[model samples]
Target: MSWWHWLWESEWHGILLGRWMVAVLLLVMGLGLAGLLASLLSRFFYLSLGKTQEDITRRELHRLMRPAWLFAILLAVLYSTLHVLEFFHLSTRWVDWIHRLFQALVLLALGLLGSRLLAVAETILASRYQQANEPYKLQLVHPLFTLGRILLFVLMGFLVLETTLKVNVGPFFTTLGLGGLAVALAAQETLQHFFGALAIFADKPFQLGETIRLENGTVGTIEKIGLRSTQIRTLDGLLLIIPNKRLADSPLENLTRTPRRRVLFRIGLLYNTPETTLQALKSELEESLGQLPFTIEKPLICLTNFQDSALELTVVTFVDPFYRAGNSSTPLSFLEIQDQIAERILRTVRRHQPQTDFAFPTRTLYIQKSSTGLDALSEVSRSGK
Candidate 1:
């Protein structure tokens, strides 16, 4: 017998491909057709997005790349295998089970592929925004992408279970509600944070890139606003992850949103400073503050307090909140501005009264104790020495 005839007619137990060789050939042809379809679809997708093989990225990011093509080809091969079995055993009871299993596997594959595709899209969008220097749009993509992924998996989970396990999703979800009560009981904090996130979005007290201060004295720039928490980059370059619930419930201040920044400080001089020198110092400081481009409105300079060793003059000024010191090519921030202001104050104080000194805390001991107590103190001191 010819080798082809021998192979075709050979039977492994009750199974033979003698007459079903035609079915095998058809199956091969069907797989080829499926592959051709995938190639054409993927090529069309790449071209539609105005991407070419010569692009910076070599990977076919428009989806339906080689892996996806192989994925589809594999599914097609599995499907053909099932049909090939039907050609030989047309009344097999297992055929329906095979079909159901195929459906479930396909759903699983689709879910995973969709998730990766979503991630790819997100990466592409973020890259584009970053290149364009639109960080506001870039930050927005992360949270939105996260939300989309969650919804995708939830929906895909239902479809997969309904197909594979033959579970009725509607009734399952209804029963799940009762079980969810216990789950919710255990995750009350997570739920609170979730709702707080919703509140943040709705109210928009602050946005990404704005500076905010919490009542607990934490100051930082808003970096990310996620479903459960917020990320802040503090001035000292530390990253703080704060729960959304606490952020929403607390008294928060949006520093960047203010119209002006108030600067208040007390300048102390020796108590022996003459009244004329004090008045002159106050007048010049006020004039200097008003002439500054950053400061707004009349500054208040008054003799507010008399400390133990010095007289205190409180200086209050309202500066343009958005001001960045323009003294140099690179503008200075709030801290730098504060340093410069201190220098200016020192110069003014010196220019007004060269001989006057700034005060330091001092104490004078009064030795007018009773003679008996003094004698006892002297005796104790003599003994100690």
Candidate 2:
């Protein structure tokens, strides 16, 4: 035989080592082929993204595609190596065991790849909806994916038990079914909380870091929202934990949604003040308030009522919900703005004091006696003298 033919036909002195080297060479070749195929597939995939190029972000592409390519390469290399080993002279039992081990490894890799792909899909969809301003579009994504992952692992376990360990999976599946039922029964309350969280996500009643006031006057900032419960940081700096069910069912006002705060108050003045002066005072208040920070809207100042003792000037104004004070990035509350307005009102009123006297409850008394009674009193006094 020729030299090349002899090399191909001859098992070297170390037959096992030669077979191992041959398997390794086949594995390397399979890896290269798999890599090339993966690159083509990825290229085609990106090309297919005609209009929806941004559908999968670069980060997501890396997260999903990298794992997929690696999985493919691993499968190809392992499969090629195992198949090559079958061509060699080996004990039947050993070959069978090796095949079973390979099968188990394949099952694990497949399951992991499936789980990761599902996660990538969910993440892409979630981000797409969130970007489109449909915050609730994929509200059920988390719970569903979590459920999917559990099912995948169970299935992988069943496969491994049946194919790798040569065990009966029938009884295990039956047991799983009954156990699942029992678990459902025991976790009823937990399920309720989970569904409640789903509803909250769907409705978007409040968001993290937002201030909300509940029906029962519970005011707090949303710290965290979880499947079982939501945590709130109360105004008093206490952490409040509320079950998701309760929070989703209760009515809550999103304080952060208000663009501005409206304050209405009445300032009473003496009825004796002139009408022109009243008009001037109202105009003055409008001008003064307009000068304050975040007082962009013209204030409403009108004569609202004529009381028993005074004329009431009612003023309604809107102040921006939050304001940065004196070069500080921290926002001062609207309450402080209300206080500042009160000061301005007082100063404006004081400018016209005495003339614009603040009205108070007052009474005037007059004493009178009849002329005949006075004359009779005078006669009695003269007789007594």
Candidate 3:
């Protein structure tokens, strides 16, 4: 008999083919129903949640729905597989293939669903940790969550390849290591910058909106904190780009961290001023600084120097550091403060020591006369006064 006629005449083939077709139709219908239900649920869930809710919560709920989808698909596959097997009368060859395929699909589904569930759990946990009363702020929690995400996705990828694709992980890992090494070599500087950025974010040497002094004396307000660099706006209205590696390694002075700015300075006066005047000058200088709106009291002013030509008084005080360095109302620059202090000193000195004069270097001119009376008479006769 011909092979086609033989196959068609066989009782087993007839029953199995008929049952297989029915099972296929059933699986298709089941999948359609499940998809419709899942869609409706997802739509309702999303609509109820609203756009105003936190992104984390929204993403987490979506991730959590993945398991429900997997379950629906799994039920359809399982039902279809069973019916196909029974109809084929337990044919070992095709049955084994079908079993392995179902097993692979189940593993893949579980892996994907598990990953989504883990993501949802992680989001929920992170949000809870953020809200909890803790010693560290929410900034500290970001790194942990990021690390968790990386690890989870890497693990999920490995599982899918190993269990579902049936690939050997050992040699794959070896090849991955070599590939990673090459990539590391090619992007060493970029990697360094990335880690440097991480260090900056973790250590917080300078925060957003804080004033910082660079090693090279560039003082600016940090306008942006990016992954690779920081952007700053200077007092001169110029923007600065500072690399993350340099910022991580360099010594930075954060002016905003301190509650008060200590000003240690000296004011000079004419040495001819008396001790009583010097003492009075010191007290008045202290009082004057105290009267200034920004300067903190009680000011410490002392006659610190008794130079040959001038007296130097030391003034130490604190001020509000937030005051702009060059603004009109209480400029924070060293030169401006010195000028203000100098003006105050001159006013005080003028009021107290009206006769006292400032000292300056001078030379005396001498003319020797040959015979005092004769030379004087000859010179007086020869030249005009």
Clashes of each: 0, 0, 0
**Cα lDDT of model 3 by residue, 231-328, tens digit:** 89987989998788988999988987877777776655665567777677668777887876667558888878755445666778877665564455
List TM-score per model, in order: 0.69, 0.72, 0.55
lDDT of predicted model 1: 0.74
lDDT of every predicted structure (CA atoms): 0.74, 0.78, 0.66
Q: Best-fitting candidate, measured by TM-score? A: 2
lDDT of 1 at 64: 28
Colliding residue pairs in candidate 2: none
Q: Model 2: what TM-score? A: 0.72
Model 3: residue 246 alpha-carbon error in angstroms:
4.3
Rank candidates by TM-score, best first: 2, 1, 3
Cα lDDT, model 3, residue 221: 87
Q: How displaced is residue 373 in candidate 1, in Å?
A: 19
Candidate 1 deviant stretches above 4 angstroms: 1-39, 42-61, 64-70, 81-91, 109-175, 287-300, 306-309, 320-331, 361-385
Tell me the deviation in Å of residue 34 in model 3. Answer: 6.9
Off by over 4 Å in 3: 1-137, 140-151, 158-169, 185-212, 220-249, 270-277, 292-294, 306-310, 320-385
Ranking by lDDT: 2, 1, 3
